[model samples]
Target: MSARRPYTVRFRTPDNNTLENCFYATDAFQARLLAMEFNRYIKDHPNRIDKIFSAAQR
Candidate 1:
């Protein structure tokens, strides 16, 4: 099994501001999913994810 690592998810807000968050997951796909799930619960309604990559790559 692979260990989870931190990934940085860059997303655009409704106001056109680009923001970033760090999520720990087994892979980039999982990190993106987690970001989307998090966006769902925010009062902003929807935030489009711009990119997702390993935090170490930054």
Candidate 2:
């Protein structure tokens, strides 16, 4: 596996609230990918999450 670094993931919830969590990734691309995966997970569950974004995206 590639070496990973700490990244912060910020996402909005279905309730219109925001949440953040730390994730590991080899690079920004991978980090966003991981965030998208997590976003999918949240979407699959009710009131879980609404959006997935990288703190560094902006």
Candidate 3:
């Protein structure tokens, strides 16, 4: 296996706050998935605006 590098996933939260999350993955696909999941969680809750912030998943 290859070493996992720290990947950054940046997106605007539902509160209009730009957030950057660091993930360790071998490729961008995995990093994207992580970001998508996080974005999904941020959307699923209440009292927040839900929007697609991912490039592919959006």
lDDT, candidate 3, 1-58, per-residue tens: 9777777666665567866666677776676666667667534642343232334343
TM-score of each: 0.78, 0.52, 0.55
Stretches of model 1 off by over 4 angstroms after superposition: 41-47
RMSD of 2: 4.8
- Give per-model CA RMSD: 2.8, 4.8, 6.9
lDDT of 1 by residue, 1-58 (tens): 8999999988777688888888899998888777767766332443467788897888
lDDT scores of the candidates, listed in order = 0.78, 0.61, 0.58
Per-residue alpha-carbon lDDT of model 2 for 1-58, expressed as tens digits? Answer: 8777777766566666778666788775566666667667544552343333444653
**Which structure is stronger by TM-score: 1 or 3?**
1
lDDT of 3 at 32: 67
lDDT at 17, model 3:
82
By TM-score, the candidates rank as 1, 3, 2
Count of clashing residue pairs in every prediction: 0, 0, 0
| lDDT ranking of the models | 1, 2, 3
